[model samples]
Target chain A: MTPHLTARNAFIAALVLALFLVPVYAVWIGNNFVLSLFTRIVILAIAATSLNLIMGYGGMVSFGHAAYLGTGGYAVGILAFEGVTSGFVQWPLALVVSGAIAFVIGILSLRTRGVYFIMITLAFAQMIYYVAVSLNRYGADDGLTIYRRSQFGGLINLSNKTVFYYLCLVILMGSIYLVWRIVNSRFGMVIQGSRSNDRRMRAIGFPTFRYRLACFVIAGMICGLAGVLLANHTDFISPAMMHWTRSGDLIVMVVLGGMGSLFGPTIGAVALLVLEEALPYVISVAGRVVTGHDVATAKEYWQLILGPMLLLVVLFARGGIDGLLASLRRG
Target chain B: MLLFIEQCLNGLQLGLLLFLLAAGLTLIFGIMDFVNLAHGSLYMIGAYFAATFAAMTDSFVLGALLALIATFLVGVVVEMVALRRLYGRDHLDHVLATFGLILFSNEMVRLVWGPEGRNLALPSWLNTAIEIFPGVYYPTYRFAIIVVALAVAGFLYVIVMRTRIGMLIRAGASNREMIGALGINIKLLYTLVFGIGAALAGLAGLMQTPILTASIGMGENILILAFVVIIIGGIGSIRGAFIASIFVGLIDTVGRAFMPDLLKLFLSQAAASTAGPALSSMLIYLLMAVILVLRPEGLFPAAGNR
Candidate 1:
C-alpha cells in the first residue's frame, strides 16, 4: 500500500468514526453541552465548506461570505415572524432568497477581477448588513428570537438537542460528499482551471465568468442552508451574523483547516470553534501558572494569543491543519 | 435651506477624512501592490494614542502631535515586521496577513485600554459655533476640520506633484522594476510610504475622535467608506479618491438625513422608517456598482496602473 493513500484513508476513516460517535459518546457521558457544541460546529463547518468551494477550489476570494448566512437566517426569522413556521416552506423560501441575492451579487460583482472583486463583494454585503440593521420589524440590529422552532410535520424535532445534533452531522457529511463530487467533476475541472489561469481557460474556449458566477451562486445557496441551520440551532438570528468581520471568520475557518481539501473546512470549523470554546480555560490556567496572580481577565485576552496564531499560520502554515495532515501521510 | 447647507458642510468634513485615508491607501496599493486591511487598525491606534496623550499632557495640540508621531512609528514597525514579507505575494496573502494584524491590534488595544470608547475633549475656542454666512452658524471645530483637511490636501498635492520624492513615488507606482534597477533603496521607500499612510490614517482618526469618539471597530466602518471612495474614484488614483470621497460623503450624509423624510412623503411612515437608513446606505454602493458597470476602471484611472 502507498503510505500516502493508506495514511489519508486512515485519517478519513478516523474522522468519520469520530463524527459518527460524538453524539453517542455525549449521551453516554450525559454531556448535552458537548452535543450542542458539536452541532454548532457542524453548522459552521457547512458554511466554511461552502466558502471553500469558491475560495479554495475556484480561487474566488469573496470577502463577504457571511451575507448568505444573514440572508438565510433572516429568511427563516422573517417567515417565522410572519407566522409561517413550516420547515418545508421556510427552508425553501430561505434557499430561494439566498440564491436570488447571490445571483444579483454575482452578476454585478463578476465584472471585475482581482482586488476589485473582493471590495465589491464586501460593499454588497455591507449594503445587506445595513438593510438588516434597518429592519425594525424583524428586530433590527438586536436580531429576532425564533420562539417556535420549525415544525417538521412530526418527522423530526429540532428541540431535542441530540436529534438536531445528528441531523447537522448527517447534513455536514452530505455537504462534504457533494463538494467532493463537484471538485472531481467536469464542472469542477472548469472551475479549477479558471482559478489557475482565467485567461488560459478563456483561450481554451471556456466562458470563465459564467462558470465562476455559477460557482458563486452554488456556494451562496449552500451557505444559505447553513444559515437556516444556524438560526434553528441558536433559536436566534441577528444582523451581526452577516457582519464583514464574521465573513472574515468564515474565510479564516476555510484557510485554517486546509484550503482546497474536501474535509478542510469542516476540520477548520471544529478547530476554530473548539479553540474559541477552550481558549478561555487555557488562558486562565496558563495565566495562573505563569503569572501566579488572579487571572480572570486572562480569558478576555485569549484573542491576543489567537491573533498571532492566525498570523503564524498564514506565514508558515499556508497548508493549514489539513496540509500538516497530508504531509504526515507522505512522510 | 439651512439644514441643506449644514448637511453639505457635514458631507465635506466626512469627505475630507475619507480623502486623507484614501490617498494613503491608493499610494500604497499603487506603489507596493499590497493590500493592507490593518490600515484601519492604524487609525484606531491613532485615536487611542491621541486620547491617552491628550489626557496625560492636559493639552490637546501636544497630544495630537505626539499621537501622530507614535502612530507613524507603529506603522513603520508593523510594515517592517509583518507587511514586508507580504510584498510581491498574491493579494490574498496581503489581505489575510493584514487581517491577522487587525485581530492582533484590536485585541491588544482592548488589553491595554479597557473596552470603553474614549472621547477627546475639544478646546472651548474650537467648540463654539461661528456664523460663516449671515445667520448660518456652524461648530468651529467642524469648520476647523474642513480647513485643516484642505490645508493638508494642498500640502500633499505640493509634495506629491513638486518634490523629488514625489517623482520617485510616481515613478515607482508606474514602473517599479526600472526604479529597482536604478539602485534606489526600495525597502526604505516602502517603509516611508507605509509610514505616511499610517500617519494620514492616524490624523483622520485623531481629528475625528472629538466628534465620533475613539471606539473599537470604528476604523472598520469608515475604512469601508474609504474603500468605496477609492473604488469610485479609481483604484491607485489620488485624484480619483479625492473626487469620490467628497461625492460619497455628500451622498451618504444627505441621503441619510433626508431619504427617510423624503420616503415618508411618498410612502407610509412605517415603511419609510425601515427603508430609509437601508436605502440611504445602499446609495453609495449603488453608485459604486453603477460606476463599475459603466467605467470599470473607475472615473479616474491612475496613470501608474496603465
Candidate 2:
C-alpha cells in the first residue's frame, strides 16, 4: 500500500480503538457523562454515514435526511407509548415506515433537479414535521417519553450503558462495511455513475432513476435505524428531532468528515459533537484571556464562529477532515 | 359572510407579502443561477432592522425606509464578501454555505439583540381598524401592507417589462454567457439583482413584523413557503412566482381557517380538531407534490430559462 493508504488505515485503526475503549476510559475516569456522550456520537455517526451513502457516493444532496430520523424515532416512541415495547416489531416497523416514506419522497422529489430537488425534500420533511406536531394523541409538539427500552427477548440488555455503547459502535461499523461493499458492487457503480453523469449512464442502458431511488430508500432506512437508537438513548420523541436544521446537521457531518469516505461520517460525527460540547468552553477560555472576565454568555455564540468556519470549509476545504488528514502526509 | 370576507382579505394580504419575497428570490435564482438558502436570513435581518430603526426613530415610515436601504446594502455586502465566490459552484455547496450563513445570522442576531423577540408597533393612524364595507372593518396596517406590496409588485413589473435594465435582466436570465460576451457588466448586474432581492425580502419581513414580532428563525418557515411558491410557479419565472405565491397564500390561509370546521362536519370534533391543523399545514406541500407529479416544470416555465 502507498504511504497515504497506510496513514489513513492507521488513523482509522486508532479511531476504532479509541471508540471501543470509550466505556473503559469513562469508567476509569469516573465520568458516566463521557460514556453517554460517546453513545450519542456513535448513534449520530450512523446517521451521518447513511447520509454519506447518497450524498457523497450517489451524488444526491438530500436536504431532509432527518425526516427519516423522526419517522424511526416516532415509530419506536409511538409503539412504546401504546404498550408495544417489543424490539422486533418496533425496529422492523421503523425501517419499513422510513423506507416507504423515502420511496414516496424520492419518487416525487427525484423528478426535479438542482434547487428544486432541495426545496421539495425540505418541504416534504416540513410536512412530516407538521404532521408530527399535530398528533395530539402521541404528545404533539411536547414529544413522548419512552419509559422502557426495546426488549430483545434477553438477547441484549440495552439498560447497561456499556452494552448500549458497544451496540451503537457495532451497528456503525456494520453500516460502514455495508456501504463500502455497496459502493464496490455493480449496483453501487451504477449509483456513482449516475451521480457523475446521469445522461451518460442512461445512454449506457442503465436505468439511473430506479437505482437512485433504491439508494435513497437504503439511506433512509439506515438513518431510520439511527433514529430508533436516538429515541431510546434520550427516551423522548418530538417533532424537534426531525426539524430541517437537524437534517442540516447530518449534512454538515457528512461534508465535514469528508464525503464518500467510509469513516468520514463517523469521524465527522465525533468531531462535530465533541466540538459542540467543547466549543463553549474554548470560547469562554479565550474570552477570559481577552476580556479578563468569565464572559458567561460567550458560550452561546459558538455558532457565530462555526458558521464562518463552515463557509471557509466549503470555499477552501471541500474535502473536509478526511481530506485534511490525507493531505498531512504530503505536506 | 363577514368572516369569509375577512379571511379572504387575510389571504390576500398574506399572498401579497409572499409575492414580495418570492419575486426577489426568483429573480436572483433566474439571473444568477445561484441557490441561496440564506435569503430567509435577509428577511429576518430586515425585520430586525425595521424594529430597531422604528424603535429608535419613533417614526415608522422613516424607520422602514432606512431599514429597506440598510437591507439592500447588507445584501450587496453579503454578495461581495461571500456569495460572489459561490457562483458556478455546485448547488450543494451553495446549500451548505448558505445554511452556514443562516446559522451565523441567527447567532449574530442573538448576540446583538438579546434572545427575545422584538415587536414593531404601528403608528396610531395605521393601527386603527378601517371600515371598508357597510358593516365590516379591517386593520389599517394590514390594508397598508396590501397596498404597499401591490404597488411594489407593480413597480417590479414596470422595471422588468419597460426598463433597459429589465431587458438586460431578461437577457441575462435567458443567456448568461451571451450577455457577458456582449460587454454587459454581468458582475454589476448580478450584484444589483442580489441587492434588489435582499430589499424585497427585507420589505416583506419588516411589513410582517407589526403583525408577528421579529423573532429568530422566523424567516425559515415562510422561506419554505416561498420555495413552494417558486416550485409550483416554476423557478426562475417572476410571473410564475407571483401567481404561485398568491395561490399558495390563499390555499394556506383559507384552508387553515376552514379545514377544522369542514372536517368536523364529516368526522368527530376531536379528530377534526387534531387533523385540521395538520391537514391544513400539509395542504400546500401535498399540492406541491401533486404538481411535481403532474407538471414537474411548474405552472409557468420561463422562456429560454432552465
Assess the local accuracy of residue B77 in candidate 2 as a C-alpha lDDT between 0 and 100.
Answer: 100
Per-residue alpha-carbon lDDT of candidate 1 for residues A1-331, written as tens digits (9 for 90 to 100)? 2334566567767877887888899989998888888888899999999999999999988998999999999998999999999999999989999999999999888887788878888888998999899888889889999998888999999899878888888888888888888988999999999999999999999998999999999999999999999999999999999999889888899999999988889889889989998998998989899998868987987778788888888888989888988888579
Cα RMSDs, all models: 1.5, 1.3
Model 1 TM-score on a 0 to 1 scale = 0.98
Candidate with the greatest lDDT versus the true structure = 2
Candidate 1 local Cα displacement, residue A169, angstroms: 1.4
TM-score of each: 0.98, 0.98
List the candidate 1 regions with Cα displacement exceeding 4 Å: A1-5
lDDT of 1 at B112: 86
lDDT score, candidate 2, position B181: 100
Error of 1 at A239 (Å): 0.6
The interface RMSD for candidate 2 is 0.8
lDDT by residue (A1-331, candidate 2, tens digit) is 2344567678988999999999999999999999999999999999999999999998888999999999999999999999999999999999999999999999999987778888889999999999999898999999999999999997998888999999999999999999999999999999999989999999999989999999999999999999999999999999999999999999999999999999999999998899999998999999999999889999989999889988998999999899988887778
